[model samples]
Target: MKKYLGEGLLIVFSVLFALFINSLAQKYQTSQKVKVAKESLLKEMEQNQVIMTQWKEKHSKILKHIDEIIKNDSLQEELIKDHFLDIGALTGQENLISSLVTSTAWETAQATQILSELDFDTTQELTYVYELQNSIINSTLPDLVDIYFQRETHRKESLLPTLIQFKLHFNEIVGQETLLVTLYPGAIEKLQD
Candidate 1:
């Protein structure tokens, strides 16, 4: 009877050991998946920065053109203030996406006030539009890049090749306005394949 009891206890221990190992393996897989999700999110944010850069370049040229037309350096700076709403806010500002947009809209209101005051000629406006292709949007791109890389360094594991691939994909998409989009409204529809 003692021998039989010892054999039963041995089987029970074996079962429990197997269950624990399986649970650990599952947990490891889950951790990897979370890392992957975080990596993908970072890539998405990078691509959005590219789009923002393009828009900033275009807007800058537009403002410069307006300034040239108006023949005032003040107008150029004012246009930057107007388009960005707050130059300082964008320079190295760190905030979540929602608050950033709100701040930008505020600066834009100021720019619009200035734009409204202008009496631009059709030829000058047409020339501004023509320059759009060459101009670079200097929006919140650099800072955005910094934030993403910083976040990834903290992940500590499951830093797969997909992270590099995603960076490559982002570089390819940069300057491609089709991929650039605002954070709200139809952005998801535009972003998702």
Candidate 2:
């Protein structure tokens, strides 16, 4: 009976040890995955930051030109007299082009449930940043396109109204871009940590 008892104890201990080892291996694997996800996210954020900064600068410049055109009657007259020929020139480009900000890494992380591994603060900040980015893409870009097309179609009969609309939309977009640009750094820092 004593020998049987010793054999039973040995079997239980072996099973427990195996479970402990398996748990440690699972944890190590999870940590490694989190580390790789963080690195990918950090790189993505850095690239987005650069793109946002560039777009912000471009938008700010365009906004300044729009402000000047709006405030100065002479400039408006010149623009109209020229048949709005310099609209592109005023905007510092032949066409107003928007740069797209990417969120693939963040989306992939979320899809894979990696975001749950992140701390609350990091996840919250990234969510805010990406939400704002999606807002710009979904809301602001379409409005800008509408304004641009409206300006193109009605420049002869409704120049001032289109210009005013453009001003309002551009102002809103620039403000959004500025806020988003400010957010990128903090999110990147959290991921690096």
lDDT of 2 by residue, 153-187 (tens): 34656766777887888889889989999999999
**Candidate 1 clash pair list:** 56-137, 56-138, 57-136, 57-137, 82-111, 85-107
Q: How many Å off is the CA of 162 in candidate 2?
A: 0.9
TM-score of 1: 0.33
Estimate the Cα RMSD of every predicted model relative to the unseen true structure: 22.1, 2.4
Q: For model 1, where is the 10-residue window of minimal lDDT?
A: 94-103
Which residue ranges in model 2 land beyond 4 Å of their true spot? 77-87, 94-98, 151-153
**Candidate 1: tens digits of C-alpha lDDT, residues 113-143:** 4323223442233223223322322333443
| Winning model by TM-score | 2
Cα deviation of 191, candidate 1, in Å? 20
What TM-score, computed on C-alpha atoms, does each candidate reach? 0.33, 0.88
Model 2 TM-score? Answer: 0.88
